[model samples]
Target: MTLDDKKRVLREMVLHRRFEERCYQAYIERKIGGFLHLYPGQEACCNGVMEAARPGHDYVITGYRDHVHAIKCGTDPKVVMAELYGKETGCSKGRGGSMHVFDVAHRFMGGYALVGGPFPLAAGIAKGIQLKGGDEISICFLGDAANNQGVFHETLNMAKVWNLPVLFVCENNQYGIGTAIHRSTAVLDQYKRTCAYDIESAQCDGQDIDTVYEHAKTAVDFVRSGKGPYFLELMTYRYRGHSMSDSRGYRSREEEDEWKQRDPINILRDKLIAAGELSMADFTAIEKATDDYIENEVMKFAEESPEPNVADLEKYVLA
Candidate 1:
């Protein structure tokens, strides 16, 4: 990536961090109701991967920690905030708050609320692409805990068997809600689990945007080349609890502090500064601009947008 490209990604990562921080404040103030998950430390995982893949062109789906991913995939940030606020102008028309943000026009399929639910759905999308002879690949982002589900194995096996172009990204944040992964999952290394299905896999430091982008670029290229499925496990952490309601009492403060020291945003910023590509003043300016955009634009739109009409409550129901 060029220096300018790195700078752009740095700016984007800053925006994502500030956006999620604002969401946390909104949730606390009761403006955003229901199961809000903030992606503070995991900014690089979404930004880096999206940078490697064509966001608006390729198919993207993930679990409920999805606001940042949707934005990276070209969904309007204002509409995402509106969705969290349950406004009629939301991406899902305010019907799918927090968890089910969807914008098919941009090909950001949807964020599933059920754990492991997106596994097979991603495969199905890839199968459709194969049948249609399309070059687009389906990307599924899920947490470490979701890997334990039956669908995880089933999806990988089927993806390889049919040579489906799908990339399964595991954001292994080390904890599933309140339980550390080791307590719930037998194999600690998430990438190694793909060995059962004979699919190629790798793991990397999720806090470093450069590292993620490099590895993700290779994985994306491999999958898009019609080589079947690839699994990438990113070792990262979430600064907040699993959801707005989670107290996060299961984890220790020392562990959280240690992870915070290697924060993704800071890693990229420091790297640029050391390389003489960016100055502290430039970073401060980027922060201010992002803050203004989120507050003046994103928050304002969500706050002023109209709530869903009472009579139209059944609008998008499939039944």
Candidate 2:
């Protein structure tokens, strides 16, 4: 990546971090309601991978920890914040809230509420691309725990059999909603599990944006080359609990502190600073700009946007 790309990624990660922090405050203040899942420590996983692919051109889907991914895939931050606020101007038109941010115009399929739900959905999208003879590939971002679902196995099998153009990215954050992954999963290494499906797979450090981007680029290329599916396991750790309601009692303070030392945002920022490619003043300016944008633009849009009208309650309903 060029110096400019690195600087752009650093600013994006910082903005995502601050945005989620504000969401935490709003959730606590009862201003935003729902099963809020904040993405703080895993910014690199999404940004790096999406940076490797064409954001608005490629199809992107993931589980509920999705605001950052949507923003990276061309969804405006203001609309994302408005979605959390359940405002009419939200990306999902105020219906989906934090869990289901859908922006098809950007080819960001959605952030599904169901665990492992995106597995088949991604495959289906890839199949459509295959039939249409388009060069687009579907990217699915999921957690370590979602791999346990039967759909995980089923989707991989179908993707391989049909030679679907899809990239399965597992954000292994070490735990699943208070349950440690080791306690629930039989196969510890998620990348190894892909071998059974005969799909190309790799694992890498999710804390480093550069590393994630490098490996993700290779994986994305392989998938786009029409060589079937590729699986990437990013060994990451989330700083917050599974959701706002989680107390994180199952995790230790020592573990938390250890992971914080390798925070994704800090990793890239320090690398840039160490290389003299970025200065403290430059970083400070970036922080200030992001803070002001969120405050004066995103938050303001969400806070002032109108709630979904009662008359349109059945507007988007399928039934």
Query: TM-score of each candidate?
Result: 0.98, 0.99
Summarize candidate 1's per-residue lDDT along 1-319 as a digit string, tens digits. 7889999999988989999999999988999998998899999898888899999989999999999999999999999999999999999999999999999999999999889999999999999999999889999999999998899999999998999999999999999888999899899999999998999999999999899999999999999999999999999999999998988999889999999999998998999999999899999999999999999999999999999889997776786
Q: What tens-digit string does per-residue lDDT give for candidate 2 at 164-249?
A: 99999999999989999999999899999999999999999999999999999999999999999999999999999999999999
lDDT of 1 at 258: 99
Model 1 spans > 4 angstroms off: none
Query: Which pairs clash (backbone N, Cα, C closer than 3 Å) in model 1?
Result: none
Candidate 2 global CA lDDT score: 0.95
**What is the lDDT for 287 in model 2?**
92
Candidate 1 lands at a TM-score of 0.98
What's the distance in Å from true for residue 13, model 1? 0.7
Task: Candidate 2: list runs displaced more than 4 Å.
Answer: none
